[model samples]
Target: MKLSLKKFIKHFGVLVIGILCMSAGVALSKLSLLGTSPISSIPNVISNITAIPIGQLTIAFIFILVLLEAVVLRRQFSWQNLLQLIPGSLFGWFIDAFVRFFHSLPNQTYIEQLGLVLMGTVLLSLGVFLEVNSHAIIMPGEGLPNAIALMHQLKFAKVKVYNDFILIGISLVLALSFTHSLAGVREGTLIAAFLTGRLVNFFTEHANRFVDWMTPATDANN
Candidate 1:
């Protein structure tokens, strides 16, 4: 039991940090004024349109995704999946807070902006690495797609690729319709998408030892 308790604490702590990194990554990407991840593409467009805070819009978007998950899973939707809401909420709030905090910092040059894109990508990849290792919960951004893939008996990778293209395309249409230009979908979106999976895999291979020590808990009730 002591071993289990210690493992839980360590893994939980890592999970919390991982989620924070993901939030920070999103905020940094937004601050760059270049683009954001596909998961955030729609909410970012809506935020630009409604002049609503992106974080608030993200929360709403996450709720919608969670609902989608429920719809896709139906009876298969367990409490474990429902638990995505908590982190989803925090993910939004953290994005807002991070954006507000970093809003003042300027990336005047294209190089500097690119630097942020790279940093955000690294943070995001690292976050996913740690989060998956912790085995605590899924963020709604990925959860919706995962649920869909599960239901359709499709590969998660292929589903995720299709999902991302759809998101970026939708955001492009929305931005063109209202904003008359790309608001949240840009080359950086492509950059982040292209790099994130590679980095996640890279981290998985190189950083395995850092997170391989503890395993997620299992119990009779769980």
Candidate 2:
């Protein structure tokens, strides 16, 4: 019941690293000119259409999800849950910074673009795995499903599928409406959706040994 400062710090550090990786992956995917991760699809499209920074839009989108969660969960939602805004803001900032950093990268050929997408997928999956394992903070993209599951007393996996469908659908509609074509949601988005979860599970199964190694003996024992 008591929290351990050391453990909390460790998980916090891991969470930051995961955010960095996820942001990098998102940036690379965008640069590839193929597609973006499903969770980022709407923000990326809106950014392109509205000229607003993707990071700023991402932060806004995440806050909206948090508000929705609060509305749905009502009494079950505690003020402490609002603390997620800090990490969400950090994530959005990182996404913006990485997008700027990768903006000049070249991906001319079809092969090169595909390679970028694949690499981005790996990074995104690894990041999600680490973030989930850390359990330090919840990304709103992930937290929305959690809130829905809690509210409906349904399975998390089922809620997650429903949430992803809703996001993809919204992104598709926005892309078509604003750009008059599919922009952010495309084949690569499908690839990421299909592979990221499997990769996360694979990494999660294999990551515990490394995590244990990094943990202090005292912490491990406890």
Candidate 3:
């Protein structure tokens, strides 16, 4: 039982780390003055219109999106899925709160800029690792890509291309309609997907090692 408890704690530790990483990624997106992922983009739009923090908007948006997913994908619901939102939203809120404290330090150099990019990479990987491992509910936007892959019987990579392109188009439309700064959409969309894929791959490679290490040893003694 103690072993089980310890394992559980370890799993949760990964999750906690993952959430913090995700939050950091979000904060980086804001700092880049570029737009964010589709989910975040919609929230950004709402934030601009309402003068609300992006995190608050994202939380509310996530809730609605999850509720919609529950309705659409009833049989897919699992503890991992349902519980995931807690960490995700909490991380977002925390990052948002921290973002309030600092915009950026003045007189930063190219090395600092590189460091921020790496920070974003780490956070994106960690968040995605937790997200995939949670085996719980995936965020609606992420889930959508998976669903498309399943329905079309295609590779996730291929489906993701379609999913992201569609989202980018939608974001463009919304940005134009609302007259939000076009910089985020113009600059952020495709680059985010590419970088996120690389980061997620790194996360998965590490996770695979962890999973292998944690697998119970088999023996005939029992």
All candidates: TM-score: 0.92, 0.92, 0.75
Q: What is candidate 1's lDDT per residue for 1-222, written digit by digit as tens?
A: 343665567767787898899889988888887888888888888888898988898889888889989999999988888788888888889999999998887788998888888888889888888887877777887888888899999988898899889889999999999999997888778988899989989988887667556344343222
On the 0 to 100 scale, the lDDT of residue 68 in model 1 is 87
TM-score of 2: 0.92
Residue 29's lDDT in candidate 2: 84
In candidate 2, the residue pairs with backbone N, CA or C atoms under 3 Å apart (3 or more residues apart, or in different chains) clash, namely none
List RMSD in Å for every model shown: 3.1, 2.2, 4.3
Worst 10 residues of 3 by lDDT: 213-222
Error of model 1, residue 105, in angstroms: 1.7
What is the alpha-carbon lDDT for the whole of candidate 1?
0.84
**Regarding TM-score, does 1 or 2 come out ahead?**
2
Better of 1 and 3 by lDDT: 1
Better of 2 and 3 by lDDT: 2
